[model samples]
Each structure stands twice: as structure tokens, then as C-alpha cells.
Target: MVSTRVDELNSERHRFALGIFMAVVVAHWAEHLAQAVQIYVLGIPRPAAGGVLGSVLPWLVHSEALHYGYALVMLIGLVALRPGFVGRARTWWTAALVIQVWHHFEHLLLLGQVVAGANLAGRPVPTSVLQLAVPRVELHLFYNAVVFAPMVVAMILHRKPSADERALTRCQCARPVLV
Candidate 1:
């Protein structure tokens, strides 16, 4: 009976983790769908379209398959690292919203004003780098810090003293992988 109860608990944990992972995946794909509709159905230009129409969207869309592949790998890896956004649902969701808002503002502020031509992978890409200044970069960095503050707080709050001390020590030495 004890073994069965333990198994059931583990199953519940796994299901919760899977649900969180699925939410992230679904949000990203929904963003992609919005981008497609904006680009094709509305007949909007690439740069302008993404910023105005798809700016609030979450997916990291790439123009080519290679870009998409790389993004997918990174996304999966990041998702796997946490497995779930465990603990403090309100805090995590608030963090996510802040991050999303900051990201959209980044697009609008950075990419909106194009004054010079930029190059990418031997291709002459036109961008607004000249319009972006040091102040904008600083502001964006500050926004990023603020957005991540909740996660940091959560970790500090949830960490046990023994485990925390051990983690600190392990950082100075070689860390062990549970798997």
C-alpha cells in the first residue's frame, strides 16, 4: 500500500510537470500561428508585420528551417531543465507576463527605427541599429533584471539551508549529476 501511494504521488508530479511544459509549447505555437495569419492573410511586410501584429506573441519565429531548428533545440533544452514552472504559480505567471511585455517593448523600441543597413551571415540585412542608442540598451537590461527578480526571490525563499550551502560548495568544486 505504501509503495502504491508513492507511485501515485510520483505520477501526479510527472503529470503536473508535463502540463506546464505543454503550456509553454502551446503558447509558443499559438504565437507562430498568429504570425502566419498576419503575414499571409493580412498581407503585411515582414518587419512591420511581426512588430505590430505579432509583437505580443511568444514564439521565436525564424525565417528559415535552420533557424527554426536551432530555436526548437534551445527551447526544448530550457524547458527540460526546469521540467515545470514548479512552486508559486502566481509568481511564475506574473514573471512570464512581465517578460512578455518587456520583449514586445524591446521589439518596438529597438527594431522600430531603422536608419542604417545591417549585415547577417554574408547577407545585407536592413535594420535600425543606428537608431538604437546606449540608453535603450541600458533600459532593456534593467527591464530584464526586473523580470527575473521574481524567480530569484522564489529560489531564495524556497531553498533549504543545508541544500543551499551544499549547492554553494558544489559550485566551487565539481558538481554531480543525479542522472
Candidate 2:
């Protein structure tokens, strides 16, 4: 039963699954954007500007486990839904996966540092490798933006595919073009 359901998800139901996943991704982006607005526009202190959800649950927003879990979820979703795309869409989706792999690694590193009670380079807060070059908030925002860019491209190509690409895909994600 489990195997059949998994197959159905990656095949016939892939479009619906991808749509739901993308909605979550967009909501996450909205949170980051809202945080940016809070910091830049409203002049909220950086520590206080925890985004929408952060405003409500500040502790959860600061948790490394939550960040790592989201990264893992993004990685899993990209891998799981990959079979729904083909040709250029697949290529773009793969690009996003590659970037997310790195993003996931960075989050893992942060989580590890937190668990070990040691920050990288002897910093007070848990810091990612890239965080050495960029501040945490900016670095994460950049990472999310980069991963989202190729994802957007993949989704666009997936839905408006060429004849060959359309034929290759199992999902009904493609839209019909008027003659």
C-alpha cells in the first residue's frame, strides 16, 4: 500500500503534490520578505525582526533544528518530485537540487555547532561556513533566493513544456497552448 501510494504521488499525482509543495515554499519566502520589511522599513532591531511566524513564535524561529528540518524537507521534495519533470525542466530542477544540497549542508553544519555547544571560528553564535563571509540573516536570505530562482524556472518550463518535454512527463502539469 505504501509503495503504491508513493508511486502515485511521483506519477499521476505529481502535479498536485508539486503545487502544494510550492505553496509552502512561497509562504516561507513571504516570511523572509516580511522579516526584511520589518528590519529595513520598520527599523525593528535585527534580533526582534523575526518575520511573521517569528513574531509569534520567536523561539521556534531561532531554532537550528527547525532550519535544518526545513532544508531537509526542501531537499527531499526536490528529489521526490524530480521524476515529474523532463528535459529543460529537469535540468533546471536539478540545478535547484544541487544548490539546495549545499544549503542543506550549511544548515546541518549550523545544527551540529549548536548541538556541540561550539560555534565555528570561536564565534558566540552558531555560524555556517558561508556565514564567515556574510552575516546570518543576509546569508540565509541569499541562499533561499538562489535556490528559489532555478526552482521558479523549472516550474515554468515544466508547465509550458515543448512537445517532446510534454510527452516525457507523466504529470498533467503542462498547459495547452492555443494554435
Q: Residue pairs in steric clash, candidate 2?
A: none
TM-score, each model? 0.32, 0.95
Error of 1 at 77 (Å): 5.4
What do the candidate models score in CA lDDT, each in turn?
0.40, 0.91
Q: Write the per-residue lDDT of candidate 2 for residues 105-170, one digit (tens) a residue.
A: 999999999999999999988999999999877888898899999999999999899988877777
**Once all C-alphas are superposed, what RMSD does model 2 give against the true structure?**
1.3
Q: What ranges in model 1 sit over 4 Å off? A: 1-11, 51-53, 56-121, 125-179
Best by lDDT: 2
lDDT (10s digit) by residue, model 1, range 1-179: 96554444333453444345446544544554555566668886655444332465423332333333433443442333232223453355356445645445444433332222333223343222322443322333444355445534533432322344344321111224355
Per-residue error for 90 in candidate 2, Å, reads 0.4
Error of 2 at 7 (Å): 3.0
Model 1: lDDT equals 0.40
35, model 2: CA deviation in Å?
1.0
RMSD of 1: 14.8
